[model samples]
Target: MASTTTVPALKADRPLLGIAFMLAAGLLFTLLDTAVKWLTQSYSPVQVVWARYAGHMLVLGGYLLILGWPRCREIMASVESLPGQFVRGLLLLAASTFAFLAFRELPLLQVYVINFSSPLLVTLLAIPLLSERVTAARGIAVAVGFVGVVIAVGPVDWRAQPAALLPFGMALCFALYQLATRRFGRNDHPLASLFYAGLAGALVSSLVVPFFWSPVALGDTPLFLLVGTLGAISQLGLIMAMRCAPASLVSPFLYLQIVWATVSGYLVFGDVPLLETYLGAVLIIGAGIFLATRKR
Candidate 1:
């Protein structure tokens, strides 16, 4: 009986561990975004994106080399679901490009809040796209989340510049990208999808980089490399988290990234959002958590 009880307890801990991993992955990704924004002040957004993908490829390639060609080939060839993979990759590329633009124009936390709307969008999209039933709880969650977004937008000062639209576009594209990822998840190995995504992003960015390429300073090279490596690690951790838990359960944990971003923004840039921003963030997070806890 003691062994049985211990086993159940251990099983219970697994989901918590998965949540922790998801949170860490989100934090890493947020850091990567912040770093890119910093770099963009001195380099082109395309240049930073290219460096990120190039670095990702190098890290993945090194890992594959250590793991051996056979395993690498197996993973790459595991792409039985090529069409879905390609679609997901295309959507991701669009999302990444827009996100880079958003980072260039907006504060980190503001950009993050806008992007956080993706989960709610995904929830709504899943209904029509996946033909999943939308329950009352989900409807309420979605409504509340949107309300939070409205609150967050209250202090934006949009008339000063219309570039704010970039982040909203980024959010929409990212939402679609996540939806595509769900479709791909039904058929492909997570690592396999990631490998292909890295390949696609690298190739696309490489082509664009040459047109906009500016010489990098020695000091900046290390930062670029760090951004790429962290991005790769974050992707890996996100895959693991998704594999270990249901999307809904893991999805809510992403909002914790806002907490990380808030602290980082304060420390790194002396940025402080308005009270409405915090209130909105809390509402959106609470709504997401409510949705995550609802019984299907």
Candidate 2:
């Protein structure tokens, strides 16, 4: 077998820095998702999502103002693929909406376990969309991941727990979102992509929120703003991490979110995953890591 190792474009000495940033980003993402889950108890998913994007826009807008509009305009004009950028933003919006709904409807741990399936989904999708070769190890990994999902989900009495569909849908949308990010996000500036995505989300959700709008209670505003800030920070950190390291190295760290989700769910909501859930999560995360690390 040929060695598939390639020299990393980034400095070897800086791997720790990349890893640290990625871990921090993962933690922030977990916190963002957890906050959405918490707010869901008192607010509709639409309302929670709207608040998230609204806060994100306000923060980014302030940052842009500080940098000056002309600089922002120059940054925007530097992009060659506005249509691709817009599509990526649209996919992100859909993924966020579905994920918020999942958090609202399911336990945070369950929602994250399902969302973690995105890496596996990305692997499978890459075969066709990315023309990446899928080796036997990857095939086995995919099979094992699916089995883990079954074990995690356990005796899907879908008729009884129709809400289960929401997480699964969130997973699918998120997978698609990641794929879009890989495809369209390369040419775009990370900050620009973040700004556009937040703007797109805010505009789309704002239009939808009127139909489902309930007046925001006084106490929830802080939580809402925190969620958005966390969301933006997490995404920006993720982009920086990916730029610094290969996906195979960085992707495994995402499983850390599962740990955070489980602990947070227990601490916050007194929710515990069943034994099967733990087994499934272990299988899925393990298989994903194995597949991601396998020599090409």
Candidate 3:
């Protein structure tokens, strides 16, 4: 999904830089997720969603102004792409909400393990939606990836831990979100798409976050604000990473987030992953890398 065709070839000549950017993005994202998980412990998921999107909007808006606001009007013009922005935002909102809900009850490792399947889902969806052909190797990779998901989730009763399903739902929503970005966002300025993503999420979430809003204590204000800041930074890192190197190189590095998530989960929450989680992560991540690196 990160391997969009629209990324300019001229900007992607530095694979090493892209790899570094991707690593940084992954780390920032892991931290952002950890913060969201912690905040969701006290506030509603919708409120956290609001912070994520709202902060993203503020940062991106500032950066756009700093860059001389190139194509500013075209980017803000809603007539051409309002519906696409709405759908993409709603899709991501669902994904983030599900992820936060899952984080409240599940270990970060477990949530990330299931969420990592989004790329695999994207490959499968591309076959039909993008008119792309799936060779046997790619097909096998997708199948093995889902098998790993089952291994990660185990055969536990859903009633006992229904939150376990939330990550899977997040992965699905995020996969569609990626697809929408590729399809509907191919022609727009990348910054515009980023800006609208933040705006759309903020707009939709604004409708609900107010009802669930809890006033932050003065001391905790910075911590709450950090959530959104980290989100914007992570997203900017992802864009820069892609610009620095070809998608194939930069995309696989996204798997590094699982390692960060595992470490962060252990240190912050005292949550240790089961041996099976390791085995499953190995399988899922291996398949995803194989699929990601394979020639399309």
Worst 10 residues of 3 by lDDT: 3-12
Per-residue lDDT of candidate 2, residues 45-163 (tens digit): 88888888888888888888998988999777755557656676677778788888878878888877777777677677756654556788777877898888778878877798787
Q: After superposition, how far is residue 243 of candidate 2 from its true place, in Å?
A: 3.8
Best TM-score among the predictions, by candidate number: 1
lDDT for 263 in candidate 2 is 89
**Candidate 1 lDDT over residue span 187-284, tens digit each:** 45667877777787888888889898889999988999998898788877776665555455566677777898899889888889889889999899
Q: The CA-based lDDT of model 2 is what?
A: 0.73
Please identify which of the two predictions, 2 or 3, would achieve the higher lDDT against the true structure.
3
- Candidate 3 clashing pairs, residues 3+ apart or interchain: none
Give the alpha carbon lDDT tens digit for every residue of 72-121 in model 3: 77566633467776677788788888998888888887888888777677
Model 2 weakest lDDT span, ten residues long: 1-10
Q: CA lDDT of 261 in candidate 3?
A: 89
Clashing pairs in 1: none
Stretches > 4 Å off in candidate 2 = 1-22, 242-249
Question: Which whole-number lDDT from 0 to 100 does residue 128 have in model 1?
Answer: 63
TM-score for candidate 1, residues paired by index: 0.90
Note the clash tally of each candidate.
0, 0, 0
- The TM-scores, one per candidate, come to 0.90, 0.88, 0.85
Best by lDDT, which number?
1
